[model samples]
Target: MTLLYIHIPFCDSKCHYCSFNSYVDKFELKSAYMEALKLQLQADLGRFEIGPGDILSVFIGGGTPSTIDPALYEPIFKELWPYLQKGAEITTEANPNSATSSWLCGMKALGVNRISFGVQSFFDDKLKLLGRAHRAKDAIDAVENAKNAGFERISVDLIYATSLDTPKRVEAEIAMAHKLPITHLSAYELIIEEGTPFEKSPNVKKESIEQSRRVIQSAKDAGLEQYEISNFGDPCRHNVGYWEYRPYLGIGSGAVGRIEKERHYPHGILEEYIENPHFKKIETLTDEEILEEKIFLGLRSDVGVDEKILPAQMLQRAYLLAKEGKLRTREGGFYNPDYLLSDEIALFMLG
Candidate 1:
């Protein structure tokens, strides 16, 4: 079963740490972008040979999907309905400030069953530091409103380990998040991506392992299981599709798609994509590259790589690593306990 990811590249405001291909001044391009995106999706559906009952999940992520008018999503959903499975988990990432009750209800009516809020923190000061458009109360209201609007599966994102963040702060955030009707939580450590505002900001600090562990323990205490390094709870199926190396389609500017061993990337610039929906760059991955990805991606989540896929020598190394307590074996595959060392373990086993 294949997965679909649609990227919305519009945002009301750009966050300090975000380097995503999103724009705050491009509000005028929204309608044109949506039309172009739908066209691309329609063309891709035919090109990929996607038919009725072939898709397992759909994720609409963005610069801030909530900022867009939900009515514009109808056409795309109508086109996708025939291909979606009976109980496909369709999700949309929304911002607290813009994910109004109306937007929530509209998306739900359009087949979106899950809503992931970009609630980086439940503190006004932290929100300000992160350049978030929403306040602490806005996040609470958004979740409550989403629940009231009949959303069952809900997720919230948390950013920890910023200079303004502390162990107490993370614990408090987890406590508050647990109190919400959220089923999943993606607690991430703040990373300063180069070329972003945070990269040159002295306020951004390096995250410590101990700080992360404390935050993780708090999430676990709040009933969210650490299924992946940064993700917790039952896990997002669409994201899991990526971790398991399943072929998926990506639509919109700067989006990447992978079908079998072939990968496709539409133009990174929004204007270029709008001019020609087929302005895509494609690459076929080598077997070695695919294998390395399998190991790397598999180790980062609940689904570990099958031992059968490894060479005999690599399998022996995996066993040795398991013995040393770096990795754990279960269900006929090796799993890493400390996801931070996943790269090191994968490389060591590869050697």
Candidate 2:
């Protein structure tokens, strides 16, 4: 089964800490971009030899999926309908400000069963600090709107470890999320990425290991189990497919896909992509590189590294870590109990 990811590169505004390939002034190109996406999707579907009922999941990610009209998405859904497996998880990411009731209901009509809202925080001040366009109440209403629109699997994204973040603030944020009709919550730590506004003001991000721990504990207390370091509650099948290294078709500008050992990157520039949606720059991955990714991704999430994939020395190191209780061995794989130490553990195993 193959996973499919569609990228929408238009946003109402760029966040302070976002370095994603998204454009705020590209609203004029929305129609053209959607057409380009279809072009690429058609070519890729044929090239990848994806047959009916072969698609495991579909994730429409973006600058803000709700920015586009659901009418525009109808064609894409029609194209995918025959190929989607029964009960396939179809998700779309939306901003609270743009995810209106009409928008939510429209997307649900197109078979998007899941909606992941970008609700970084519950505090209006924190939202402004993060350059979010929505108010605290907007997020709450958006989730309610999604529920009213017949969405059963709803997710919210929260950002912590910012300068204004405290243990109490983080707890309050989780408390607000718990009150929502959401089945999943993804609490991510603030990473001031290069080329973003936050890069110039590095002080905005106050990295605190304790703060992260607090966020995790709060989510757990709210009944959202931590399946990955930054994720909680029910696992996203599309993301798990990625961690498991399943083949996927990345359709759109700035999107990426991996088929076997080759990674395919569509053009990053919107104009360039619209001109030639079929074009792709491919990178071949070596055996060692793939294994390293598996180890890193596996350790970072509940998806443990399979013992069969590890080399003799690496397997021995995993055994040692398991002995020390840093890792747990189960079902021919080694799992990391503490996801916060995943990077360090991955490095030690690599060494």
Candidate 3:
């Protein structure tokens, strides 16, 4: 099965810790960018030999896809509808402040079955400190609006481990999230990315690793399953598609796609993409590299690698890990309980 990813690199404002290829001053290029995205999608239909019933999901992520007028998505949707499988999960990421009632309604009407809000936190003070444009109330309102717009699969993002994220604060956030009409929760730790505002004068003081574990336990107690390291149920299908090594088509600036072992990356510059949609660099992954990804990605999520693909030595390693209580065997593969150790496990097995 294949997945489709569309990137919208426009945001009303940039967050302090964000290093994404988003721009606030490129509003004038929005229309052209959308046009280019469509062209790129059209190009993929030809280049990848993809047709109807091939795509399992479509995820439109961004610098804030909510900032773009929902109407702009119509053209691309119309082009993709003929090829969309029945019940395909179509998702779009929106910022709480920008995803108003009308925008949410329009997206829902346009076949967006799932909505993920970039609600970094449900606390106003933390939101402000994170350079988020929305307040806590706005996040609540936005989720309510999405629910009213008929989105049953809704998700929200949360960041923890900052100095401001006390145990009490994390509990409060989890409690609030559990009460919301969301089916998914993506909890992440604050990282001071290079070239980001947080990297220069980082105001964030990280909470202890134990605090992070507590946050995960809290979400699980609230009934959200930890399907991945940082993501809780209802985990987006597009995310699972990646861990399972499902091929996908990537459209728009900074989007990457993989067809079998071949990887495709389009021009990252908005203007450059608009100028030439087909300008992309392609790379083919070696069999060894693909095998490594299977182990690395499988150990990080609920999707486990195929035991049939494991070498005798790696199978022994997994058996040892199981004996150590670090791994479990199920679904004809081995899974790790501690995702943090996934990389190390994969490396050890690779050796």
Candidate 4:
């Protein structure tokens, strides 16, 4: 079975720290882009030789999926309905500002069972600092509307480690999230990406290990298990699939897909993708590169790496780390207990 990711490159407004391939002025191209998306999906389904009931999960992410009308998503869903496995996890990301009751209901009717709201912070000042269009009340209302629309698996994305974030403030953020009827929470540290507004003021991101621990402890105290670094509560199957190195079909401009050792990238330019959605730039992965990814991705999450996949030298290092209590060995796989040290541990194993 394969996973599917559909990207919507339209946003109501761009956030200060967002460097994702999205545009606020391209609303007029929404219909044509979605149609092209269908064309690409049809071609990919055939090319990938996917059979009925082979799709394991579907994640509709984007510039902001809530920005597009649900009516435009009907045809795409119709095409995918035949291939979706029973009880498949279908998710869509939304911005609290645009995900209204009608929008939430419309997506629910089209087989989206999960909603992940981009509610960065609950404080109005913090929201303004992050350039978010919605206020705290809007986020609360949006999540409530989603629940009212019959969504049970709701997730909220929060950003921490911002200039305005303190340990107390981070705890309050997680507390606010806990008050919501959410099954999952993703607490990310603010990373100033290049070409974004935050890039101009790198100090906007205040990296504090204390804040990170506070966020994690707060979520765990609230009964949201820390399955992965920055992720708490019920695990997102699509995200887990990615960490497990499962092949997924990426549909839409600026999206990516991986099949076996090959990674595929469609045209990033919106208009170019609309002109030829089937066109893709392919990159073949070497054995070393694949192993590196398995090591890093596995170490970062609960998906431990199989010992058989590691070379002799790396396996020896893993065993050493396990002996030192930095890593845990279970069922012939090696797991990292402290996800924050994942990068350092992976580097050691690689070296």
For each of the candidates, the C-alpha root-mean-square deviation to the true structure, in angstroms, is 1.1, 0.7, 1.2, 0.6
Give each model a TM-score: 0.97, 0.99, 0.97, 0.99
* Tens digits of lDDT, candidate 2, 216-280: 89999999999999999989999999999899999999789999999999999999999999999
Per-residue C-alpha lDDT of model 3 across residues 1-351, encoded as one tens digit per residue: 689999999899989989998999979999999999999899888888888878899999988899888889999999999878889999999999899999999998899999999898988888888999989999999999999888999999999987788888898899899899999999998888999988987768586778878888999999998988889988799999999999999998979989988999898988888999988899999998999999999988989778898889888888888898888888788988887677888888788
TM-score of candidate 1 versus the correct structure, residues matched by position: 0.97
- For candidate 4, what's the RMSD? 0.6
Q: Provide the lDDT at 26 for model 1.
A: 74
Question: Of the pair 1 and 4, which is ahead by lDDT?
Answer: 4
Local error of candidate 1 at residue 268 (angstroms) = 1.4
Q: Write the per-residue lDDT of candidate 1 for residues 18-64, one digit (tens) a residue.
A: 88889888788888888888899999999999989999999999888
Clashing pairs in 2: none
Angstrom error at residue 220, model 3: 0.7
Off by over 4 Å in 2: none
Cα misplacement distance, residue 126 of candidate 1 (Å): 1.0
Clash counts per candidate, in order, are 0, 0, 1, 0
